[model samples]
Target: MSDTHAIAFVRNEMLPQAEPPVTQRGLVKWLRENMFSTIPNTIMTLLSLYVIYVLLASVVPWLFNGVWSGDSIRDCRAALDGATGGCFAVIRERWPQLLFGSYPSNLLIRPTMAFFLLLLAAAPVLFSELPRRLLWFTALYPFLAYWLIWGGSIWVPLFTIATILLSWLVFRALESRSFFGAIVAALIVFVVVSIVLGGPVVALLDSIATIRLQPVESRSIGGFLLNFILGTTCLSLSLPLGIALALGRKSDLPFIKGLCVIIIEFVRGVPLITLLFVASVMLGFFLPGGVDFDLIIRVIIMITLFASAYIAEAIRGGLAALPKGQYEAADALGLDYWQAMRLIILPQALKISIPSIVNIALGLFKDTTLVSIISMADILGMTRQRIMNTSEWFGVYWELLGFAALLFFIVCYSISQYSQYLERKLATDHR
Candidate 1:
């Protein structure tokens, strides 16, 4: 009787899980969670939809009804026949001027090739998974791009490259003893080599001048090409300069820190336009007589200085955000000042500052439009002065401005997307 009472337990088995409800799955779930999850959100969603609809209603007709084939705004208006439309014919007729400015039609291939090659050169640096060997091309790219865009004697870039390589060799040979001494030695070696070889190099290149592309004057460089040249050059230059400034600001030496502080504060206090104006007009006054500086070079220098100041502040914030434990750990490992900074501190600080750096880069790229104020024929200048002001395309503002905006958006958006990717790739918290 007792055994029978104890033997009444039931067998147990695991139950299979059911699929989520349809309303909690797929696109409907996403919209419910993100767009219409609450009363306020629902109202905002509707308002946003209305705004989008209004924009499309106005812009779609203007875009689709655009006259792609026309000689003038009159032809475009006649084609539209009192309907809303855009005169894209200005873009069609003056596309070359927009892209290359006064760049020779025969030499268009050079810049075209250089532009595509830039994508290749930038790939490895932007994406870490790419082979390190690709960085050789990246290193060679500046000289290649200069030759392509400026169409100078090929020997000039070659000599520059040779000097750089030789200087690097000298630096490496001396770096084990002293970093500062190595740098000084490298500079001396570079100067000596350049001077000794400059004449013979030019003479040799002159003999082969028939094989080279015709040299394009710096003044002939304009349009979007000029903007791109300035943006890329300044962006590349400013990063290292900014890093140096940030580190200098944190240095133990009073002189170094004071100099960095003064530079950053002074530059940050002044508006970028003021600096640009000074570069365009005032900088020449400071130079010796008979020394003529190129306008584009002056602009590049000014933009780089401006960008570096902002970027230095961003980097300094990153450095400050770092935990004391990191520095302690680096010191515990018996690392020297430069080694600790280079290997431990910078990698993490720069990673943290990626977004800020990208912001500075985007702003710098757009600021290239400011070159127009100096009477330089950047894309904005070309569009405003050459394209819109012309009798044939007069009063066609929206299409040309919109096209410029689209181009800038494409480039800026690409930079933003790349920064996001880099952030994800470098994330190590396992979150």
Candidate 2:
């Protein structure tokens, strides 16, 4: 009786695994919980499905049956023969102008090289896991890119690089003695050297030895190339400038703080379109006689300044979010202000500010479209001037605009996805 009682609960083999119920597992479970968890949710889900279906029903056939080969909208319509289809031939015919604008066909290789090289330069900066040495290329890329796209005497960018290096050297020599003095000296050296190099020095260098590309005017730069140039240039410039402005706004020096405040406030108060107008029309008046400032350069400057103001506020918000103890900890470690900021405060603040900064970048990139108002030929501008203005492609707005929209969406969506990935990679809250 005792042996029998002890052995009663024992089993010789394990039980077989059973599948979960249809409504409680896999796709069925997911649909039940997320799409039909409650009556309201079910109703909303069904309504959304219906709307999506209605849209796809029309869109799918139209997109799939689009006439891609045609000389004009009429040709496209004729090909469609009363069937519903998109006249996408406009995009096919105007593809080059849409991408490179009025850029010379033979010189296309220049921008193409710059474009691919840009990816190489950006890779290390975007992904920190890459070798830090790649930053050398990143630093040099701007000047190289300028030479490539604008197609000029290589000495122009070379001298420009020299100016920067000269200024940096001066700053380094004076930095330990007096930080403020170092900055002033560096700035003065930069300006003076820039003036000398821009004129006689460049000319003299050209006489001695020449490395030249077929010169292309800034005016010739249009299409998506122009948009990329503006967006990348402004985005790259605004971040560091904004960081400096954010720091200046918090400085103990009243003059520095006041100046920073004025710049940030003034730029923020003005509409960007107004700023663009100033760049296009008013900027010429400010320059000395016979000093031709390229319109693209002026627009870039204006756009960069506008973006910097917003970015400064975003960075400032990030800085403000840090605890007082972080500052105290820096002080306790015997770190000076800049040291503390660079080593500790800024890193964390930048991580926090990533989302805001990415938003600013996206906004600045899209705002390149606004250059069309000033008669600059960005992608949108090319569409208007080169395609739609022509009799053949007149009223083919949807296809051209849709192509531009698709290009922007691809770039912006990639940026957003990268930012999300970065946030996940840098996340410390879980630890």
Candidate 3:
């Protein structure tokens, strides 16, 4: 019955002959280990508890108050007891304007269809059981999406059909190992058929119509959707231009190098809005005297140039950060400069600078808001106008501003988080 017996019992059973305690499996143990493991943690926990209680004391009641039960705005103002709740009926009524702007009574279908198309296109990535055709679908999905959004001609369908047939023929030819020859043959056939279909370039040129750009007509196309267009178009246009500029900056030719530097520096020095103004006014002067210019198109051109200058600098940093040994190694492998860049340098450099690119894109997203000052009716413009009519004007500002801030934060933060994850994964692979 003494220590000797206890020792013998423990050795014999590999246990204490009974469970220690049930409290070890419950909230007590979790609290002890997780929330109060150290003195600093326990202090912080108590502080957080106090802050939460104060916040809940103020927030929870107002959130469930009669104010939130509004069916119409009149019901909302009636129930307004200086509470902290939202009148969601306002959101319900104006939701269409918020989402689609003044897109057109019938054309609302177009944006909705675009949304569904995007989700449909992305569905395969989320559900792996989807058909392998999804991979090929992405290659032409953008064109398909644009076609659905903007209803084009019969020629568009014909082009799509021809593209599909050409793809199949190329795959068939390459599956038999005539890849290089097939590619060359395909190019020749494509060029010859294009010429036959449209006649000579000169003939087509003669058939083209010249138009004049009117400023007021161009400015009419500004809205929430335009901001998104600007962002995406800027990214698409700038990325290619950036890559070219990066190459040119690193070029051996004095002329090319100097030109790239001047272009990059000049764009970087100017504010984006100034560039937009210049585009709205001065871009037309550079073109032929009678040629028409669209304000949105000119803004896009300026944005493309502006974003490209920054992008070029970012890519140049990536290029410079690469080890000189990479260039030498590419040369040693008998790769031409373009091959080395395309196959080796650029992929790694871009991967390394994905975080930087994402940051630049986030900046561009913010810069897009400036388009409102230039007369675009983006989300901010909608918010400013919406807040004025609200009865709860004092609190409405916070709610509307918070919504806008949240959208920006979520998009930018997600990009940053994803880039970090990619960076970590790449680091793991390198190791």
Q: Please tell me which predicted candidate would have the highest TM-score against the true structure.
A: 2
TM-score result, candidate 2: 0.95
Better of 2 and 3 by TM-score: 2
- Segments of candidate 1 deviating more than 4 angstroms: 1-46, 188-201, 204-211, 428-431
lDDT value, candidate 3, whole model: 0.68
lDDT at 25, model 2: 89
Tell me the spans in candidate 2 whose CA falls farther than 4 Å from its real position: 1-14, 428-431
Clash tally for model 2: 0
1-431, model 3: which lDDT tens digit per residue?
A: 67676564335546457754766768888998999989999999999999999999876764565343444555676677565566655555555555545555465676577667766775674356689788677555666655554453324434545755775576567645664456566666665555455334324443463222111222333345556667766877898899889998999989989999999999999999899888867777888867766666777888999989988888888888888999999999998776799999998888766777778888987788787676666667666654435554424554455556776687678657766776776782361
Ranking of models by TM-score: 2, 1, 3
TM-score of candidate 3 relative to the true fold: 0.69
What are the runs in model 3 whose C-alpha is more than 4 Å off? 1-75, 119-224, 386-395, 428-431
> Which one wins by lDDT: 2 or 3?
2
The numbered model that scores best in lDDT is 2
Distance from true position, residue 257, model 3, in Å? 1.2
- Cα deviation at 220, candidate 1, in Å, is 1.5
What is the per-residue lDDT of model 2 for residues 30-103, given as tens digits with 9 covering 90 to 100?
99889999999999999999999999999898899999999998999899999988999888888889999999
lDDT of 1 by residue, 1-431 (tens): 67888887676976789989999999999999999999999999999999999999999999998899999999998999999988898889888999899999899999999999999999999887899999999999999999998886777888799889999999999999998689889999998988788778777877977346689998888899999999999999999999999999999999989999999999999999999999988999999987777889999999999999999999999899899999999999999888999999998899889989999999999999999998999999999888888889989999888888999999999999988888888882332
